[model samples]
Target: MIKTKRLLLRRVRKEDWKAIQRIWKDETVSPYAQYDNIKELDDLSVTNRIARWGREAEYYNHIFFAVCLQDEIIGYISCNRCVDAYEIGYCFHSKYHGQGYAKESVLGVIAYLLIKIQMEKIFILMVEYLNYSLDGRGKCMKIEHVAMYVNDMEKARDFFVKYLDGKSNDGYHNVKTDFRSYFISFDDGARLEIMNKPDMADDEKALNRTGLIHIAFSVGSKERVDELTHSLSADGFEVVSGPRTTGDGYYESCIIAIEGNQIEITI
Candidate 1:
């Protein structure tokens, strides 16, 4: 256990799962986490997680420390030994953010690793500011998927698959409400959920709508952008804007696709 001015850093116990669950469920915290199965966490899974942490600590010297403030677990820090240094990752309850608790706890862990454990170096992993590895090698917070209501789910699914090169699932249907949906996945691990339901409102989308104006996709280069813009235009999709560089220097084009929704293709 390590103590700071107002916090306690200790080895996590099985009972700490509830506190950890609350942290994981926080909207501000979970999306940035690499725990794709967080929503499925329960007694069994959390207990197994704790047990796995124990095994990791024992077998590989990897450590997970629960951060406590005033006798309450508010966050955790994980230190995993990389090839040459320890990579540190952490998450705190959103309520405790900007309180310097994270800094203090990280300092405590760094001290323990460097002095007590006699480690050579430490690296702090920042998920928010970096493109995180998706090969199960590191933690990152990115848009898992975006869901949108569409009139024709299959048409939307085919549009993404044919033009955007998205691979879609078999699709899902609910017998009770006549609801259906498809999960379209892209090469970079991003996803789009197109859903449909009976009697869903088909509101006329205005030009200057307030909420969620568009979804932008990066196609890697100006040539690809031009090719896709021309392809989409050939397919009768209205080109709303240019394949020319914008004032901000984005080589892109805007189009009306997927049920009148705006899609931006950029380099």
Candidate 2:
């Protein structure tokens, strides 16, 4: 069993078949049906159903979990193993609709996979993907194989090109996202993620988190660090600290942005 502060991921049992079937049967659900009205799992014996899944789960390639919220099962989240990663799939019961429970549950799922399953990479592959571009720019970010949200498709497209197109400096990227904005990624695998919060608003709220944190970028040498900082500052991205060595042997500086996100340069 993989348990988080608010949820648990455990094996599906005979008792869960009905709830699982019921959730799948809902017409309101996307990806529509597990089986058509004619072949609906109405007649499948519970033992047979369990036997079907039990053998498969034992294979270690697929782990089917009944997502339990507050000790009560309401949905299912599963990971299907691929060549070098796991694809996560989840479905929630409409009965628990609008609770933000899905997000929390998925968070738990990631932690579970990272900690227990030790999955190197996990991707969300939605059947009918959705994305939220609250930025009003109508742009959507083609993120790590996740659902597409309801937003202006054009703006979302432009958003990816302008900000989220996976470019980064020294393995880091900071960009505006929907609502609060987002941090983009680079090809080498270092990633950044943030909400739709703009630099101004995020900066203000970030200081409230009470601890100091900043994005650190490494340059080739102290002189190059100085040159880059001077050029970037001239270009209007606030340059904070730098050319100074930390007690631990790295040279660095912090630049405060209107959003309070830091641009740290180091050598």
lDDT of each: 0.80, 0.56
Model 1 quality (TM-score) = 0.50
What number of clashing residue pairs does each candidate have, in the order they appear? 1, 31
Candidate whose lDDT is highest: 1
For residue 136, give model 2's deviation from the true position in Å: 27
lDDT of 2 at 37: 24
lDDT (Cα, 0-100) at 164 in candidate 2: 24
lDDT of 1: 0.80
Which candidate gets the maximum TM-score versus the true structure?
1
TM-score of each prediction: 0.50, 0.42
TM-score, cand. 2 vs. native: 0.42
Q: Which parts of model 2 are misplaced by more than 4 Å?
A: 27-39, 45-47, 127-267
Residues forming the 10-long window of minimal summed lDDT in candidate 2:
145-154
Per-residue CA lDDT of candidate 2, range 1-267, in tens?
767767777877666777676766663454432322222345464344544455455444566788887767788877766646778877787777678767877888788778877888989954432334223564443334222221233343343334323432322224434343344443323455433323332123453366546556544345656776676577576655565777766666666532445557764
